[model samples]
Target chain A: MKNNNKKKIKIPKGSNILEGSRAVALTVANIEPDVVSAYPITPQTHIVEDLAKFKADGKASYEYVRAESEFAAASIVVGASATGVRTYSATSSQGLLLMTEVIFNMAGLRLPIVLTIANRGVSSPITIWNDHQDAMTVRDAGWLMFFAENHQEAVAQHLLAYKLAETLNIPAMVNIDGFILTHSYEPVIIPTKAQIKKYLPKYSPTKGSYLNPKEPMTMGSFARPAYYQEIRQSLQDDLSNSIDLIEKEYKKLQKTLGKDIATKDSSALIEYYGKKKAKTVIVAMGSVVGTIKEVVDENKEVAVLKLKVIRPFPYKQIIKNLKNAKKIIVIEKAISLGNVGPMASELKSALQGKTPAKIYSIIAGLGGRDITKKKINKIININSQDTNKAIFIS
Target chain B: MKEIRVHGRGGQGVVTASEIIAISAFKDGFFSQAFPSFGVERTGAPIEAFARIDTNFIRTREQIYNPDIVIILDASLLGSEAVKSGVNNNTKILINTTLNPQEIIKKYPNLKNKQNSLLTIDATGIALKILGKNLANTVILGALAKQTEIITLKGLKQAISEKFSEKNQEIVKKNLKAVSIAYDK
Candidate 1:
């Protein structure tokens, strides 16, 4: 697609079947961010490229900066956000890893910037595939994290993320499993520019919060050891307390942009599917939850717990939902290198002596490997017999 | 629900064809999902893309194992094992080659004498003649629309126009002509 011929078509007010990246880009354009600086990486490449194209064709009003590196891209967003502008950036895998330092800086400085992580596997053997490793690497960076099951939810999350992040003055990362969700095409109802303007409004920081000419106050100055602990505690406290605000913003977006825009009958943090009293339950995040939900639909005795929010961990919600299950299976795409799956480990810590459900960690679909129905059924079959060991489905 | 798998080389716009199929299905008031299963990141490398059309919402993100319809955009890939991997007797197979159905079966005797419906077209020749290029991905969709009622020609044309509408209108015109020529063939 070249940008030489710039002709606009009137998109009807309904679902437009589009690739996930394109839908997201359109939504971002409607949101009307002040700056979008990103270095392209596969899966994430389409998104930045689309946004760049929009800027080139005069469809987007934001300044699309062609950054030299991911680090520079992250730095650009941070700088723009500090000056009280709604800024956006996106990356995947190694690109994300490169942006780690700036990622934490954005959060610590209390910049309400939104970044999209087209989640991908990390290096070592060098694979360009979908996995949770990249997102999991910065799980505790104090940024509000969200995992979308599909394109619609992804669009909804972006709309809601901006509202919540701006309200709480915190950074956010919306993680879409690379390739799986980013490359897939589906019918998505992106909010119109008018709808977004009415919903998100404009970015106006509180007095003295941003770097303004009238208010001369040092920003991101070195915090001494005396106050650093409390500052960190404040971020932790706000992130944990933002649970209620997230739900509130989610409901607001749903009410503002029809019910179809929201993930059907689910909270902003988690979504439960399949039989409520099923003996076996599978817990996972990202697009894999969709496959598990399909398998659960056929099996009468299995359920699925789709974790949408990973930053807050949602441990209390996870425990509240899985208290009755006889067996719990934690399926994840990323492992903690030497230890168990990050999500499984967190679940065990959260559910210790809390639920009688025997928890099993099953790691599969590493480096873009397909998670088929047969493999899901294999997890079901393995759960029938008791074993505390983690199962890796090859 | 109907599952369609497309087999082609990287630069052949295999992923775009699958997306157009999904868009056409969506245009016809069906829920659809389309995605590609990439191998290597280079042109001419064999790749597979999939499209699923269902009356209900599509939830599964797994690659298609047993597709009801299979499309081959490159005749050179006809000899690959992947082309016939999950094909059953009832599977509808479309190939972009000049060989007729009988000639194709004769060349690849292992296609098994089953009740499978096979259709072939010289997509390359048609694309070269009309579009002045060897991009036959969209041309194959016209044959698919004509032979099978899986997707309507009107819906396919609308989807094609929408896809290429961002590009030069001349390209869209030529591609639409190629599709019509293949449809009439």
Candidate 2:
């Protein structure tokens, strides 16, 4: 009864089939951050638990702080980051909501703290599953957000997130689909310590950015009416300008690692797959893009534009990618209540008067509902026949 | 691509079974992915996990709606509606039970057919005899390897040994014995 087909197989070194949360955690540990503060929440609990295990096993040398609450966790990282040390934390759903006040402060003060938002559904009836609602809630919190489409990207993006955050002095959050990405196990190539050292050098803070007791300076100060608008505007401008820096680091990573880590288009923030001139293109973020790509590969008429970076919303790249398409379908895991999906609304506004493609918004996979290939194909079929402004796939 | 769905209650190592299958497939030079249902996680609650194995990379993140193979770790869950869903004519049912395969086919008349294959193994009994516990996940995996031929028994043994390498060597050997016993059955 034994499997007669058994043969000798060699597992390649440095490659492992790792859970997405564990991959991200291991990547964070490889970066050798100074401190990690976190509180356990469903879907996100494994991340902090893994980090704690890493510390216990002597795999990492960072100070691990088990905070009382998400708010306290956020505060602890902020303090750690302000004192000129690389810091990390992760949360989801209510935890992300609880840390909202500190989330803003971390960005407002330009603390360069990196966090992982294991994107989950916001609760009232209570659900712990995949959705973008949690991350979308803090879309305007001034933190740069990057959505990973899979476990490999989830690991690679953490290294990129830390590099980008420290380089720009802006807080960065990597949004991974809770349970979907966080709980899933897939093969990933983890960067070695030597590779990390060569790629992401030691953290040396610029003089004005760090909170040194020797040269004490005020941060998160109360701005007067005259300076308030300017401060907000400056943050906005800096976020927008970060696209260049983000692309630069991505390219540098490609050169250093000798692999194309980012999208194929060196300059584009959005990754396009399928025929470039396909009449119909589906636009999405996070893990859903994987499913879309599978369907897109089968259909010659369909294409996909995956949004890698959500904040500093890649308007120009998105518009450019969809300009020639006759139909554009925006799939979202979260709805904006009274309005359409947050992403769909943004896409519509970005495409206003810019492209002739009729835009359709489809809200699917809310609170852990599966977005199967059949559902995606159905959406494509429906959108092809006639334009639907907002269709809820239940 | 081969998709598999595992049904068992919480604390039954259902997720671990899927992971081991995936790891075994990976060890055999195939791309594999595994994930749990992430439902209410209370112990004894019906939980499911999924696995996909293919020659090429698996890009889709969707749950396996039409699994080629379904492994039932808990025989008590056989009558549940959740276990009945997504089963088609070509689906293979591998259950950890002492009942005969024909008996199971007769019990679930809707699932019986000429094309479909229903398999049963006393994995729980084997686990209790060899490992002194009711951990049938690895034993069921051995039966799955024999039925599907998706991963080799050698691959499964390697994965099981590596998984329990941190634990006592005696325990790892006992688990391997359980897998061997279930495979022979």
Candidate 3:
């Protein structure tokens, strides 16, 4: 007799220095998704390569498909997800832009697929480098977006993203800064299979949402103007209502990993570092948060409020954290052309009537440009006074 | 924290060398990071990769503007201006070349009076002899382990074994022998 319960699987413990792309790929493999369909792209290439190797080596049991283009890759995952299976795919920059149509359709159908965005700069001159512009393009595509600050967060967030997406039946996008996070290697703690199994069980779609041949139903059908607005409103409401579940899953993960990663607030969306009463606060996301935290550690008067979850925006928490600061500096990698930085614009809207802090928008580290500690200090020193336009740090 | 930058050609395993150094550092109970400078990668083009080792977690993602140690995997790259940009008076440089360090310095007058530690080893000579290929990455890694002592020779060998065993076991034994020969030199 085959005794499945007696079989032992040795999981990796302690810390291993892993590149961000490889780390995320290994995490996805461990989760044991049903299908992994992806096309190769730079910076994002290592991820799919590693996953393909895993499948080839028999380390993971999943149906691996090599799609022809990013568009086909996204469509394949969507089709696989409609058959009631956990599916995944990754893309960046132009590849991501090519998949925009399928991305919108997947989110509209409310499929619980998880996609990784190795955030890269959209090109005219052609750059295979790090930035948030690729992800910022799909900010309103109805996907739950989360940015990782480091390799550890990159691994942790993928695990959390799968669980959250499955629970809410909403697609999730895990963004890791290209090259900066995807190529860079760092020590990360990988949880055991036993722990993951306890947290994330086998994929079983919600009661009647999954497609069945016996009970065929149409999804993502065109609706009249009157019904379209209501459908959009329902999606917005579902995304807004996911806050509680996101917080719950974060708490559950904290318990499983035996680490304190969640914020003190009920909504684990905002992460504040340094002094609570800091007069100046720097707001940013993704790998740049590491630099900001290092500077905040050295200076007593400055603090950093890192937004882990960027989609739901956490308007109340953002205002609450930055209300006391006299100066708010929002440093972002992506800027909305002819307007302000996307994150800065959002921060300004969040603090419209709530705080009296003077906001300064600074754009840095675009196209793989290095954001050193010295440059961060320079920004803090020079931007003490108020400015109207966005400061371009060259 | 100690920062090391490696200079080589695109097909010379520059990025893999950095990754091995980082893995060795991790094996020795230190936190490490390795990454290549983002560039248009093409065979025979000049390339650079970086690695950092520390007792604590490293947070900064900036390129190493001032490297503590610089390893030149291709002697031909010594003529490029990028090779000399980040080196300082206190930097230790390890070059893979057939000529002696003093002779090379004499040939290039610019390197005559720099207050830096310059060391040279015929890594190609050794790699061609042992591995039957001109892959000097592991040979230079052994010399680096000996010069910096950031990671022990055993740790480097273990990391190399882990990486190479995935493809072929015979290659692992040959590379381990190459590391020992380079360390002795």
Candidate 4:
């Protein structure tokens, strides 16, 4: 009756059995960071606590900084990364929104910091379910963004985010469902230190200076109007350039792990499932994409496309992926207030001056709201029964 | 598909109960999915957790508007919004109270049909007599095992043992006793 299963079974060929938060923790720990920081909040708390325990219990050799507020949390991570050491931290809803100012500041300096976001509902009604608003607000922060469809992707993307961020010199935000994925238990195939070390190349920034005191340089000098334009352009360039590096890392991962079944397509920007038959595809981001895939697969006509990489927008790839379709269902977990969902609106602009497939914007999940399987079926049912309505299931 | 809906407040272990059942199913090689539906409601506020086990894929996402089995962790929730939302001739009602099946069928008119079965057991009493707290989850779980052949006593015992430690083995044994008592009494 006693659990004697603690010999650390090296779980060869790592299973995607881990929960989202634990996966994020394992990735950050694997990166062998210099500093880890946070102030605990529900959902987000487990991530920091797990990593902190890993650090404090002599499990990981790193500095674990428990700050006072979310503001301090971001600032701490930013300072550590500025010194050219790998930095990691996590936050949610109010905490993420609080750290937004410093979040942009970290990206503006072109710091390759990796942050894990437990997607939670923002305030006004005060609920603790999943939503995409917290990460959506930071979409324009010049950070390479990614969303996970489930626990496995949530864990896998955290590792990929670090690789992408460090390579592109553009920070990345990896968002996941809060309590739905965070506090839930599932089997995870945890990689051994030796295996992860082989896949993840050590952090080596050629240009950035460390705290040597011999070669000191100003990091945050306010540039004059003439120089500001070019600096902003460089940030844009770095973000745009990350698309290739993201795919490169993904390919390397696929090669190392016998290819990704969740994202089998060569380009790792998005994942697709179902009928591969219908021109009508429902595009979405975040955890509910799993439910959407189930519904579409059952219907036997419609297909589900998951937008894994959100920022840098995967513009050309987006147009290419949805090009074959005559009609598209752009379902956004976070709404854009005045009109269509965020991704749909962005795609609309990208695919401007040409209207091949009529896009129906369905903004269903807001402040969590139990966006179950039936609701998605109803949407698809309505789409089949009548495609005229751009539905909003709020 | 065997659809189960557990009705209880936030702290009554409804979700945990559903998960335990699902774990039992998974160990038996059955595909199962278990999830919970909660609101701004805090502890002691009514919450519903669901489980669906099927030989094939289950695409119907509707809240088991009518579940094959309805577990009442707290008898008070029998009057709650969710209880009446989905109860029918095919539904089997398992409550944590002293009232016998016939007495419950008499008290509730909706359960008048011959097809409906009310299986009542003093789950709270069983828990208090064994483990000490008002943990009707284990007792109701026992009643569930009795009312239906979803799992065997040995299989349920192994599931409980897998979930808990050596110290909690007594808890598992007592729970198994609760199941047998509820079924026989």
Interface RMSD of each: 9.8, 4.5, 11.5, 9.2
- Candidate 2, residue A126: CA error in Å? 0.4
Ranking 2 against 4 by DockQ, winner: 2
Model 3: per-residue lDDT, tens digit, B1-185? 78889899988889888889888887776778898887445788999999988766788787888988888999888777787887888888889989787887876666776525787888888999999999999898888888767678988998898767676888999999999999988
C-alpha DockQ for predicted model 3:
0.44
TM accuracy, model 1: 0.96
- CA lDDT scores, all candidates in order: 0.87, 0.85, 0.84, 0.73
Q: Write the per-residue lDDT of candidate 4 for residues A56-164, one digit (tens) a residue.
A: 7788988999899999989999888888888888999899989999988988888889888888878878867778878888898999888876655665677778778
Look at candidate 2 and give me any clashing residue pairs.
none
Predicted structure with the largest DockQ when compared to the true one? 2
**Candidate 1: segments with Cα more than 4 A from true spot:** A1-13, A383-389, B39-41, B114-116
CAPRI accuracy category, model 4: incorrect
TM-score of each: 0.96, 0.95, 0.94, 0.86
Distance from true location, Cα of A326 in model 2, Å: 1.4
Ranking by DockQ: 2, 1, 3, 4
The DockQ of predicted model 1 stands at 0.48
Give the per-residue lDDT digits (tens) of candidate 2, residues A150-257: 887777778888898888788999999998888888888778777878779999998777889999997889999989999888889999988878888888876775
